[model samples]
Target: MASFEASVQLNATPQEMFDFLIDTENILKISPPDTGLSFTKKPDKLYKGAILEFQIQGFGKVQEGTHEIIVFEEPTLFTEKQISGPLKSYTHEHHIVPAGENQITLIDRLEFEPPGGLLGFLITESKLLDLFDEGFYQRHQTLKKLFP
Candidate 1:
């Protein structure tokens, strides 16, 4: 298993930060448009057991997958597990912690294990890790711009 984590502090209230982070619409806007993500199921309110399906377009093909909310805590933490996807297993956990009265920090932790153990290690060491690093950095920048 390989782990990738990124954290960013924002000058916003925890509630405010949570609102933006939990919103799927905001995610789609900040995500690369070329990814072609479409939510199959969206909830009016966020909680445990929420399900969502996304289609990612890459290399001239669309890969479809669904994620299930495995852990949820209001205004603090939320986690989702990839139920079906290209990877063997994937889980993304989001954490929001209050820094001060009007400041908050967002933490994103992604733990994934791909198929073909040896091959997976090679892939992560080669380009996939860099790709994830860049993606998270861009996401943090986008959040900073959006929140700060």
Candidate 2:
């Protein structure tokens, strides 16, 4: 399994940050251009059984996936697992931690296994890492700007 985590402190309350993150539509606004991330389906509001279908551009192709919200706790934490996708397995956890008065820490934790074993490892360790690095950076920057 391969894992990646990133966190950013924002000048917003935990509730505020959590509300924004829970909305699937905000993803299109925050994702980096290189990711080419797009949603095929989204729910009116994220819930424990909500499923999100999205596509990512990679290796000159678009890899599509459906992520189900397995855990949902309002204004605090939520975890989603990929039910169908290019990967063998994928799970993501989003945490909203209180930093200070009117401040919060947003953390993204991702665990995944690629499909082709060794080749998948190589690709994930290289290209996928680069893609996520930029994606997370852009996401944080966009969040800060949006909530600051």
Candidate 3:
């Protein structure tokens, strides 16, 4: 299994940051070209049963996916699981906390294990891992501008 974590401070209220994140269309604007994301169903808002699809460059073909919004603690925490994707399993947890008056801290955590056993391990080391790290950095940079 591999894990990743990142946090960013947004000069917007928690609700504002949360709203921006829940917008699925934001993916198209912010996601890097390599993600190969294709919209399946857009959520009216973040909830327990929103489905999304994206093809990860290093992962195998067509990775149908869903976002199981497992945790919804209002303007604080939201979590989700990838029901189907290129990985054998994936879970992402997001946290939004008050950073100061008019500011918020966004935290993202991911835990996943790829398929193809050892071959998958090799692939991750060789390709996907670094890109995933960069993707998060890009996302944070984009969000800071939008929310600031």
Candidate 4:
């Protein structure tokens, strides 16, 4: 499986960061505008066992994916696993840690197996990182401004 991890310091409390993350509508704000992200299953807040179904426009086609919240610890961490998607498997963990009096650190970890079977070997970790780096950069930038 390929893995990715990234963290950012946000000038907000853990509860604040966690609250922002649990809201499904915020996805459109952080993602690249061209992605055309829209939720098929919209919830005011996420909870354990909640399923997230959405479609994203990419390469002139629409791709749909579904993720289930496997773990949920309020204002601390949560893990989402892809039950159906383009990839063979995908798991994402979001962690929130108190950094200072009013600051928090948000970390994201992802482990995924590419869409192919043995052919997945062609996709290197670095390549996967490069693919996600752009989106995450935009995401982090938006977070910084949101909490500033």
Candidate 5:
């Protein structure tokens, strides 16, 4: 399995941060424009067992994926796993902790593997890490500005 973790401090309460993250619509607003991300199906509000289907334009083509919310603890933690996608397995956990009177710390932990065996491991360890690093950096920057 390959994994990456990142955290950002936001000038907002846990509830505020959680509320924003739970709204799936905000994903398109924050994702990279090149991703061409759009939701094929999404729940009005995310909850345990909710599944989200989305498409992304990448690798000279479009790819679709479905994310299922496996855990949802309001104002604290949210976890999701890819139910169907290019990946062999994918799991993401979002943790929100109170930092100050009104500040919050947001941490994202992700574990995933591609379809193939050794080649997938090499690709994930090499290329995918950089891709996710850049993506998460952009996401944190956007969250900082949005919450501030």
Candidate 6:
């Protein structure tokens, strides 16, 4: 069980932030440039029951993942659970909170278990956290550019 959380204040309304998140095309814009995150199968907008198939080839590694949208709340929250991926289990929640009259707070939460049961040495929790830190920093920069 490992977890990562990050929150960024954006100069946009909750609906605005939510709209950006639900758009599949915006993903590549916010993701780390070298991650090469792309969808093999996707929908224009995200909603409960929507499934996503994606692949990333970067950091000197390549991997594929599939996730199911388990929860969707317009202008507020969206959650996805990994159906299959590098990790044994993975869940991500996107929370959009009203920050001010014309602003919103975007929060990202992730919980997962690295591959392997007792011998998950290939990917460590610390390493994952570091990766998340770097990824979110880049994401935040992009969000700021897009929203501000």
Q: Which has the better TM-score: candidate 1, or candidate 5?
A: 5
- Evaluate model 4: give its lDDT: 0.85
Error of 6 at 90 (Å): 1.0
Off by over 4 Å in 6: 117-119
Model 5 CA deviation exceeding 4 Å by range: 117-123
Model 3, runs deviating above 4 Å: 54-62, 117-122
Best-matching candidate per lDDT: 6
Which run of 10 residues does model 2 get worst, by summed lDDT? Answer: 121-130
Candidate 2 segments whose C-alpha is farther than 4 A from its true place: 117-122
Model 6: ten consecutive residues of lowest lDDT: 117-126
Q: Write the per-residue lDDT of candidate 4 for residues 1-148, one digit (tens) a residue.
A: 7888888999999998888899888767788777778888857789999999999874457879999999999989999999897678889999999999999989989998776765456655565677677777788999998898
Q: Quote the RMSD, in angstroms, for model 5.
A: 1.8
* Candidate 6 backbone collisions, by pair: none
lDDT order of candidates, top first:
6, 5, 2, 4, 1, 3
Candidates in order: C-alpha RMSD to true structure: 2.4, 1.7, 2.4, 2.1, 1.8, 1.5
lDDT of 6 by residue, 23-65 (tens): 9999878989778899999999998999999998733688899
- Measured on C-alpha atoms, candidate 6 has an lDDT of 0.89
lDDT score, candidate 4, position 73: 97
Please report the candidate that would top TM-score against the real structure.
6
Clashing pairs in 2: none
Give candidate 4 regions above 4 Å deviation. Answer: 117-126
Better of 3 and 4 by lDDT: 4
How many pairs of residues in model 2 come into backbone collision?
0
At residue 37, what lDDT does model 6 achieve? 92
lDDT of 2 by residue, 1-148 (tens): 8888999999988788777877777767888877789989988678899999999987778989999999989889999999998878889999999988999889999988767866576566556667677789988998888887
